[model samples]
Target: MKIKVNQESCIGCGACAAIAEDLFELNDDGLSQAKVAEVPEEKKEQATEAMEGCPTGAIVSE
Candidate 1:
């Protein structure tokens, strides 16, 4: 799976990082960013939760 964050839409709520710290984080710009280019099978579920939990819909998965 692949995941990405729309920086423009991200509100830096930390939900993604809280949900999947291994896969997401807040950058210096204070927006959520995907830490990995590809989502590992083991982390997919958590990534999904992060995506769903993002209030700004900044997270995207494929």
Candidate 2:
């Protein structure tokens, strides 16, 4: 699986980072975006949760 974030739709809610710090983070832009590191399979659950928890529906999975 792969993860991606839609910058325009992000609201800096931090739900993704809250759920999976290893996979996501709030960038200087103040929006929730994927970290530089690759997302692991173990984090899929929290990642998905983050995607769902996002108020703006910014996160996506492929």
Candidate 3:
């Protein structure tokens, strides 16, 4: 799975990073960004959780 953060919609709440540190992080702009273009099999569940946990619905799976 591919994960993406919509910068325009992101609020930088850090919930995604908290839920999936290996998959997401706060960038210099303080918005959450996907650490990898594609989610590793081992990290898919956590990534999905992070996506769902995002308050602004900025995280998305492609």
Candidate 4:
């Protein structure tokens, strides 16, 4: 699975990064960006959790 962050929709919240440090992080602009273009099989669950936890729904499966 691939995950992508919609910068325009992100509110600079750190929920995604806090939930899955290995999969997401806050960039210089304070927007959350996916650390990996493709999700590892083992991390899909964690990534999904992060996506769900995002208040702005900026994270999406690609």
lDDT of 3 by residue, 1-62 (tens): 99899999999999999998988889999999998999989988998889888999998898
Residues forming the 10-long window of minimal summed lDDT in candidate 1: 53-62
Please give, for residues 8-49, the per-residue lDDT of candidate 2 as tens digits: 999787878988888888889998778734568788788888
Q: Candidate 3 — what's its lDDT?
A: 0.91
The 0-to-1 C-alpha lDDT of every candidate, in the order given, reads 0.92, 0.82, 0.91, 0.93
Clashing pairs in 3: none
Better model by TM-score: candidate 2 vs candidate 3: 3
Tens-digit lDDT track of model 4 for 1-62 = 99999999999879898889999989999888999999999999999999889998999998
Q: After superposition, how far is residue 45 of candidate 2 from its true place, in Å?
A: 0.8
**What is the Cα-based lDDT of residue 34 in candidate 1?**
97
Q: Per-candidate RMSD vs. true structure?
A: 0.6, 1.5, 0.6, 0.6
The alpha-carbon lDDT assigned to residue 5 of candidate 3 equals 97
Clashes of 4: 0
Tally clashing residue pairs in candidate 3. 0
- Which residue segments of model 3 deviate by more than 4 Å? none
Which residue pairs show collisions in model 1? none
